[model samples]
Target chain A: MSIDVLLQQIVNGLVVGSVYALVALGYTMVYGILQLINFAHGEIVMIGALAALFVTNALIAVGVPPALALVIAILAAMIICAIVGVSVERIAYRPLRTAPRLAPLITAIGVSIFLQQIAILVFGRNYFTFPEIIPKTPMQFGAVIVTPNEIVIFVTSLLLMAGLLFLVNKTKIGTAMRATAEDQKVAGLMGIDINKIIAFTFAIGSGLGAVAGVMVASNYGQAHYFMGFMLGLKAFTAAVMGGIGNLWGAMVGGLILGLVENVGLMFVRGDYKDIFAFVVLVLVLIFRPQGLIGEKVAERA
Target chain B: MSALLENKRNQIIAFVALGIFLLILPFLAGMIGQAWVRILNITLLYVMLALGLNVVVGVAGLLDLGYVAFYAVGAYTWALLASNHFDLSYPFWVLLPLGAFLAALAGLMLGAPVLKLRGDYLAIVTLGFGEIIRILMNNLDKVSLPGSDTVYNLTNGPRGVTGIDGLNFFGFKVRQGIEVFGHQVTGLQLYYFVFLAIAILSVWMVYNLQHSRLGRAWQALREDEIAAKAMGINVRNVKLAAFAFGALTGGLAGGLFAAMQGFVSPESFGLLESVMILAMVVLGGMGHIPGVILGAVLLAAMPEVIRYVADENVQQKVFGLVVIAPEVLRNLIFSLAMILIMLYRPRGLWPSPDRKADTGGSAK
Candidate 1:
C-alpha cells in the first residue's frame, strides 16, 4: 500500500527467495543430469528441517550454547539429507534409468509420498516450533526494516551459490558433472564414472537444500511434517521459471517468483498467495517453455 | 467341434457366473455389513474414474497427474445444480450429461495448453492445474464482484456444499428405497445397482473405443507422437479426444459420487486422489480394461481392508500389541506399492498382450 510496506515485502521476498533458489538448485541439478524431476527432493528438505529441529532441541536441553547447537544441527542436517538424497536415487531411480519416461516419474511420486508418510510416523502430525537461537533484532534502513535472520539467509544462499558455481566451473569434479550433464554416454566413454558423478550431484544439491530447509524453518518459526510438499512444488515452479536444468536460471527464477508472489499478495487475499507461483508456472510454460536463460534447442524427436 | 469353440463356450459360462455374483453381491454384503456395500460402491466409482484416466494415460500416454480436477468439476456441477445451495434441482439424466460435458470441456482446456510439452513437463503442469482448481474451490466462498460491493458465496468455501439431492428418475428417488416383488429393498442396494449398470456401460464403451479407429490412432500417438503425426493422424484432435473422453467418465463418476453421499467438498478432489487414480490405471496394466478394473478394485479395497484388520480390537486379539497406527500403515503401503510396482512391473501387472515385445509404449 505504501512505500515502506512495499520495501518490507521486497525484503521478505529476498529472504524466502534465497531459500527457494537453494531448493531450486536441487531440482535443477537433478533435472540437468538425470532428466528427472526428483519429486522427492522436497521431502529431503522437510527431513532436513525436522532433523535440525530435533538435534537443536536435544543439544540446547543438554546445556549446549544456542549458537554452537545451531551450527551442529545445520551440519548434521546437511549430512543426513545428503545421504537421503543419494539413497533415494540409488533405490528408487537407478533401476528405472532405461525404463519408460513415465516409470521413474511415477516412482518419484511414490517416493515423495513414502517419505511424507515416514515423516508423519516419526514426527507425528503436529507442527514443531523452530527454536529462536538467532537474534531477531530488527535493524532500520531508512523507510525499510530488516531482521538479522533475513541477512543471514541471503548471505548464506549467495555464498553457497558462489561456491557451487566455482565447483562446477573450476574443479575437476565439477567438469565431470558438466560433461555428464552434457552427455551421459560420452562422459562414461571418457572414463568418468557416471554413477558416482550423479551421486555427487545429488549430494551437493541436497546439502544446499538442507541449509534452505533450516532457513525456511528459522524464518517461519515453525516446521511441519508435510510443509515441504507445497514448498517443493513452488520451488520446482521456480526451477522451471528459470529454465529448468540451468543453475543461474534457478536462482533468477526463485527470486523473481518470490518477489512477484510477495508483492502480488499486497493486492489479493493472503489465503490465495500460493496460487501465484503456479499461475506463473502455467503462463511460463505456455509463453516461454525454455525459460529466461535456457537456450532454445530443437525438441528431441 | 473345435478347441477354440469349446474355450469360448467355457468363457461365456464363466462370465455369466461372474455377472450373477456381482449382481447379488450388494444383498449378500448388506447381510454381513452395510459398510462393505459402501466400500464396493466407492470401488465401482473408482473403477469408472480409472477407466476414464486409462484413455488419457494408458491408451494415449499423456500421463495426466491432475485427472481429479475433472472429477471435482463433475462433483461440483452436481452439488450446485442438485443441491439447495442455489435453490435448484436437476434430474439425474440432465445433471449427469451436463456434468460429463463440462468435464470434457475442462479436459480440452487442459489438453490444449500442454500439447507442445512432453513427459515430465506435461505432468508437472497438469499437477499445478489440478492444485489451482482445488485452491480455487477452497477460497471461492466469499468472492467480491468487480466494480461493486456485492459479495457472493459460490462454493460455500471449505465447509463445502451439503444436502445434495440424490438421483431421481421418473419420481423414484435413489435416497428412498423402492419395493420389488413385495420385497423391501434398501436405498444403498438400489444405488449399488445403478452404479453397477453405469460402470458396466463405461467398461463396454471403453472396450469398444479401444478397438476402434480412434483407439488405434491414440495408441499410435502414445507410441510415437512424431510418427503418428507423419502417418496422417490428427495428433491434436486425438489427444484432445482422449482427454475429453477420459474426463467424461471421471465427471460422470463424480456426479454419481455426489448423489450417493449427498455432499461434496474440495478435500475429496486433492492431488492424492489424482495420484491414486493414476496408480490404479498403471498398477492394473495400462491400456488393458480388465487389468485397470482389477487394479482399481484392489487399491480401493486395500485401505478398507487395512482398517478392518488393524482395528485396535483386531490388532490386540491377533498380535497382542499395537506398534503402529493403521492409517499410517495404510499410507505407507499405498506409497510403497506405487514405487515397487513401477520398479518391477514397469509395463504393469497385466500389460496388453500385443505390447509385450514393445517398450512401455514410448519411443525413447
Candidate 2:
C-alpha cells in the first residue's frame, strides 16, 4: 500500500526479472538458430545450480574461503552446463534436425524429464539451501532498501546480457551464429561449420542458464529439484513475448513480465503471479504474435 | 464373402470383445477390493481426458498445454450447479450437458484468438489461458458477480466445493451408492458409473470421429496445414471445432470426476496434470484411440501400483538399497518409458496409418 513497499517490490521484480532475462536469452537464441523450443533449458539451469552447490560444498570441504568457493562454483557450473548444452544438441537434437518439428519438441520434453529425474536421483528431493556466501545485509537509502544479493543478481544478469549482445554482433563466432540462424544450409555452404556453430550457440545459452541458476539459488537461498519447471515455462513465455528469435527482445520481455507480475501481485495474491505472466503471454500472442519487438526471423511462424 | 461383409464382421467381433471386457472389469475389481475399482475409474476418467486432448494435439495438430482448463470448467460447472451453491439444484442430466456446453464455450473463447498462432506459440498461449482461468477461480470471491450482492462465492476459493450430490434419475440413482455381492457400496457405484461413461464415450467418439469428414480434415491439417488450407479446408474453423469438441468431452469427463469424488479444487487441474495428460496422448500413439487409452491407463496406474509395491518400510528400504526409492524410481521408469518409446516407436504404439509418413510431427 505504501510507496516504499511498492518501490521495494519493483526492486525485487527487477532482480528476478534479470534472471528471467538471462534464461530467456537461452530460449530465444536456441529458437533463433534451430527454431526448436529447448524445453530442457530450464533443467539446464537446475543442473547449473546443483553443479554450483556441489562445487562450493567440495571447495569448502577442502578448506577454501567461502567467497572463493562461491566463485569456483559459478565457473564450474557455467563450464559444466556449457558442455551439457552442446552435448544435448549433438546427441538428442541433431538426428531430428530434418525430422518433423514435433520430434525435437518431444525429445526435448523427454530430455527435460530425464534431467529432472536424474537430479532427483542424485540429489535428495528436499530443497537444498546454499551456504550464505553472499552477505544478506540490505543497504538503506532513505526507505529504499536493497539487499546485496539483489544488487549482485541485477548487475550480473545485465553484464551477461551486454556481453552476449557484444558477442553476437561484434565477433566472428557471433556472425556465424547469425548466419546459421538465418539459413543453416546456406551458412553451411558458405564455409561455416553449422554443427560447430550450433554447438557453440548451445554452449553460450547453457552457460547463461547456468549463471541464472546460480543467481536464483543465491538470491532465494534455496534450490529444489523441480524449481526450474515453472521458471522454465515463465522464461519461455518471456522469450516468446520478446519475439522468439530475438535476443534483446528476450531481455526486455523478461523484465516486462517480471515487473508486470510483481506489480500485479499488489492487486491480487502472490500465488497468482504466474497467472499474470501467462495472461500477458496470451494477450501478446493474440494481438502481436510476432512479440514485443516483432519477428526478426521471417519464417518464425 | 464380400470384403465389406468381412470388414463389418471384424468390427462387430471387436465391439463385442470390448463390451465383454468392460462388463467383466468391475467383477474383477470387486474381487481385488473397492479401492482398485476406484483407481480403475480414475484411470478411465483420465482416458477420457487424454482422448479429448488427442482431438486437439493428435488430430488438429495444435499443441494445447492447457487442455486441463476445459476439464476444470466442466468440474466447476458441475460443482456449482449440483452443489448447494446459489441454492440451485440441477438434475444430473441437465448439469452434464450444461457443463459440456459451458466447457465448449470456453474452448471457443480461447481457441478463437490463438487459432492463427502455430506450434509452440499456440502451446504456451494455451498454457497461459489455463493459468488465467485457475487464478480467476482462486480470486472469484474478491470480485463480486454482476447483479448479485453476494460476492461470487461460487468457487469457495481454496476450500473448493464439497458435499456435491450424486447422479439421480427418476426414482433411481446411478450412484445410489457402491454395492458389493450382497452389501451396499458407495464408492464402487460411482466408480462403475464413471468407468461406464468413459468406456462408452471414448469408444463411440473415437471410432465415429476417425471415420468422419471432420476426422479427415483434422488429419489433413496435421499432415500439412498449408496443403490442407490450399485444399479449401477452413483451417481456422476446423481447428476451433477440434478445440470445442475436445473441450466438450473434457467437460463430460470432468463432471464425471466431480460426481465421483464429490469435490472439486483448482489444484486438481494444474500445469502438471496438463503435462501428464499430454504425455498420455503422446505415449499412446497420438490419433490412435486405443493407444491413447492404454497410455492413460498405464500412466494413471503406474504411480499407485508402485506405491502399493513399496508400501512396507522394509521393502522400501531394501529397494532403496538395490535401486532408487519408489518415488524416484517411478518417475525414472515413466521417463525411461517415454524415451524408449520416442527412440523405438516414435510414431507411438498404434500410430494412424495416414500419420506414418509424418513421423516428425508427433506432438502436433
Candidate 3:
C-alpha cells in the first residue's frame, strides 16, 4: 500500500475512532454508575442528529446565516438529547432499579428499538444529509490530504473528551458521580443525592453522544433512522474492550477498534470492516474480560 | 370429585382440539392461496428460532445478541453440502442432521470462551462473533475453499446459493405446486412439514429439555449463577449444553428453511434477524414455550399484515399516518410493552411456578 493511502486510512480511522470514543463514554459512564448497559445511548445519538437536522433546516428557512445556524443547531441538538437521556433514566430505568439485571437490559433494548422506530416515523427511512456548513476543500499535507470536515470532527471530539475528563475529575458533581459509581449506598450516606448524580451523569453522557452524532452526520453527510444501531453496537464493544466503567479505557478501546477495523480492511474487504472491530472485541474479552483498563467495581448487594 | 374429573376432561379436550386445528391448517390454506401457507411455514421456522434462542437468553440467563449466527451456520452447511458447487451430493435427511451438528459445534466453540463472562460482556462478545461470521460469509468468495484455488465459492457470495433441491422422502418428492384433493398443495405441503417439525421438536426435544435435570440446572444458572455453581452445577458444561441445544434447533430451522425456499443467503441471517428472534422471546414472555411461539407468529406476521392493510393507497396513507408513519412509535409501543411487563411481571407471562415462588422475594 502507498504511504498516502495508509495516511488517509489512518486519518479516517482517527475521525471515526474519535466519534466512537465519544459514544463509548456514554456507555461507560452509565454502566459505571448504574451497572446498567444503556442500550438506548445509541438512539440518543440518533435523536441528536435528527434534532440538529431539524434545527438547521428551520434556521435556514428563516434566513439565518449558515454558520450561525449550524452552531445553534448543534447546541439545540445536544440540549434536547441530554434531556431525553435524563428522562429515560428517570422513567424507564428508575422503576426497575431494584429489579433483576435482565429486566433493565431488556427495557433498554426496548427503549432503543422504540427510539429508532420513532426516528424512522418522523424522518422517513431515507438518509438525510446535513447541509454543508463547512467548506469541503481538502488540505494537502505533503502527500496526505485532510478535509475541513475531518479536522472539525477530530478537534470537537477531543474538546468534548477533555471537558468530560475535567468534569469527572475536577467538579464536585464529578466526585459525586465517581462516588456513586463506587458505592451508591456509601455515596448516599456521604450526602450525595444519588438520583441527582445519576441524572447528571446521563445528561453529560447524552451531550457527548449528541456532539459525536453531529460530527458523524456531518462527516458522512447522511443520517438515517437505523444509523445508530450498528454504531451503538460498535460503541458498546469499544466500552467493553476498554473496560466497562473506565472512561479513558473506552477512548483507548474506540481508537484501537477504529484503527484495527480500518487497517484490517487492507487485508480483509471493506464489507468486513465491521467484522474486524467485533473480532477485536471478542478476542479482547476472551483475553481480558475486565477490559484493558477496567477496574473491578463490586456490585451493590 | 366431579369438578376434578371435569377439569381433567377439559384439559385433554383442549389439547386434542389444538392438535386437530394444527392438522387441518394446511388444508384450510390450500383452499385459499398458498401464499398464506408459505407465510405460516416461515412463522413456524421463526418459532423454532425463537425457541432455540430462549434456551440461551431465557433459560440459561445468557444474553446473546447474535443468535442468528447459528442459523447462518446451519443454513450454509446444508447449502454447501446439498448444492452442486462442492459436487457433494447428500440426501436431504442426512444433510439435516449434519447441518445441526455443525451448527452445534460452532455454538460450542463460541460458548467455551465466553463461559466465564456474564451479562453485557457476554452480549457484546456474541454480537461481535455474529458480525464476524457474517463478514466472513460476505467475503468467502475471495477465500479459496479447502484444497481448491478455483476461487472456491462456498457461499456463492451475496447472490447466495440457488437451485437447492427440495426434501424427498422414500422416493416421494415434496415439490411445490403439486395438486391434492382437487386443490394445489405445493406450498401447503411445505407448511405442513415445517409445522410438524416444530410441533414434534417442541414436544419431543424442547419440552423434554425443560423438565429434565439439565433444564433445571439451566434455570438455576439463570436465577443465580453463583448459587447454582456453589450448589454443584457444572456451570461451564451446562452453559455449553444450552448453546449447543439452541444451535441445534436453529440448524433444524435453517435446514427446513432451505428446503422450503430452495435457496439460502447470508443476508437472510443478519443482525436484524437476531433482533427479530430476540423480540419474539421477549414479546411472547421469555422462558414460556407457548408464549414464545405466540410471539414468533405475531412478530413474523406483523409486517406482512401491515403490508396487506396498506395495499390500497387511501388505506396506506391512513395506516402510514396512524400506525406506520412513525416507525419509532411501533417500536416504542413494543418496547413499552416489555417495560410494562418488566415492571408488573418481571418473571414474564407463564413463568414456571417454581421459579415464580423462588423469585417472590426479588419480585417485590
Q: Please name the candidate that would achieve the greatest DockQ relative to the true structure.
A: 1
Model 1 stretches with alpha carbons more than 4 Å out:
B1-6, B181-183, B356-364
Ranking by TM-score: 1, 3, 2
Colliding residue pairs in candidate 1: none
Using lDDT as the measure, what is the rank order of every candidate, best first? Answer: 1, 2, 3
Model 3 has an lDDT value of 0.81
TM-score of 1: 0.95
| DockQ for candidate 3, C-alpha atoms | 0.52
Predicted structure 2, TM vs. truth: 0.90
* Highest-lDDT candidate: 1
Which model, 1 or 2, shows the larger DockQ? 1
Give the 10-residue window scoring lowest on summed lDDT in candidate 2 chain B: B355-364
Which should have the higher TM-score, number 1 or number 2?
A: 1
The sequence of per-residue lDDT tens digits that candidate 3 reaches over residues B140-228 is: 87666567767756577888888776676666667655666886667456557656766566646888898899999998888777788
Residues B235-312, candidate 2, lDDT per residue (tens digit)? 999999999999998998888888788888889988778888988887777887878888888889987887776455
Candidate 3 stretches greater than 4 Å from native:
A2-8, A185-191, A297-301, B1-6, B30-32, B84-89, B144-150, B177-184, B306-344, B357-364
Clashing pairs in 3: A117-B327, A117-B328, A118-B328, A121-B326, A121-B327, B177-B186
Which of the two, 1 or 3, has more TM-score?
Answer: 1
Rank ordering of all candidates by DockQ, starting from the highest: 1, 3, 2
